[model samples]
Target: MPVRKLLLGVLTLCYPVAIYFGLQHWSPRVMALALVALALLRALTSRQAGWRLLAVAAAVLAAIVAASNHALPLKLYPVLVNAAMLGLFGWSLRHPPSLVERLARLREPDLPPSGVAYTRRVTQAWCVFFVCNGTVAALTAVLASDRIWALYNGGIAYGLIGAMFAGEWLVRQRVMARGRHG
Candidate 1:
């Protein structure tokens, strides 16, 4: 639970760097084997449904990379992750009380009507961000150099997410202030 909650995101982001350096020292098949071991270990340690789904996806990707003897499949992990997040957030929109709303409720259980609307909009915005980010990731994986892929996926991507978090927090504060004053 601790690893899944705290460390999983960092580990996931490191995938690009791992593959980039791994190919320098090992064969694609060997790298694929390592990925499978990591996935299996994570699966065994975590009971989260989301992690289980990701484990299956990772195993399939590993199998493809092993058989194909290529890094393309390995590089698609970010795209796959974004797709999964989009699915989760989009599904929540249809089911009501969106993903962001659920997170909001964790801190403010009795969110006002305005807060609910804001969270829904925020979830939709995240869906858009996931789509755009995944598309760029896929393009880089297919067309860009391994170094570029690692740079963007491991570095720029996290920076963009941090920017989004900061931007949203600023916007939320302004929204709350407006609600209080108006």
Candidate 2:
């Protein structure tokens, strides 16, 4: 019931739903608008700077969708979305009590500094992964003139998410092994 878990669950469900409706040729503009509205609501309720930035990015994405309706450029939408997500990620990273800090707090009080450092590194790596994947997805959509949902939700989305999950597991395993040894 934690906020992080709630966000993760919402994202997990929303991604597939977005992909499904998008592939069906639903109005991307509407989708973008809805997201923007939600982001705006969040921003209004929370005083956090990160949430405000997210709201702005969401609004920008809505504008991109509206623009794309007039002229279907290959790289336009994807590039815009990727840049927005990257900017949001960067903003979140800059703020305090980031993902790394949250994860570290979950650990035992007596846990070594190395473990905390490892967790921070892993979280940072995950942020980088999001940036790289977003860039690739955006570029592919823009240059290929293919449907963004189809391309991103197909092999690319699965592969990237799977790889990140596996990488996280591997890091956790190594951390545990080191803990056992020490």
| Model 1 root-mean-square deviation | 1.5
**Alpha carbon lDDT of each predicted model:** 0.88, 0.59
Top-scoring candidate (TM-score): 1
User: Lowest summed-lDDT stretch of 10 residues in model 1?
Assistant: 1-10
TM-score of 1: 0.94
| Residue range 43-156, candidate 1, lDDT tens digits | 876777887888889899999998899988888888988998899999999999899999999999999999999999999999999999999999999999989998999899
lDDT of 2 at 46: 61
Error of 2 at 68 (Å): 6.0
* Candidate 1 pairs with clashing backbones: none
Report the number of backbone clashes for model 1. Answer: 0
Score candidate 1 by lDDT.
0.88
Please write out the lDDT profile of model 2 over residues 84-152, one tens digit for every residue. Answer: 555654555677444655656777656577766665676577678767777776556545544554557
Q: How many steric overlaps are in each model, in order?
A: 0, 2
After superposing candidate 2 on the true structure, give the runs of residues whose Cα lies further than 4 Å from its correct spot.
2-32, 41-47, 67-98, 146-149, 153-155
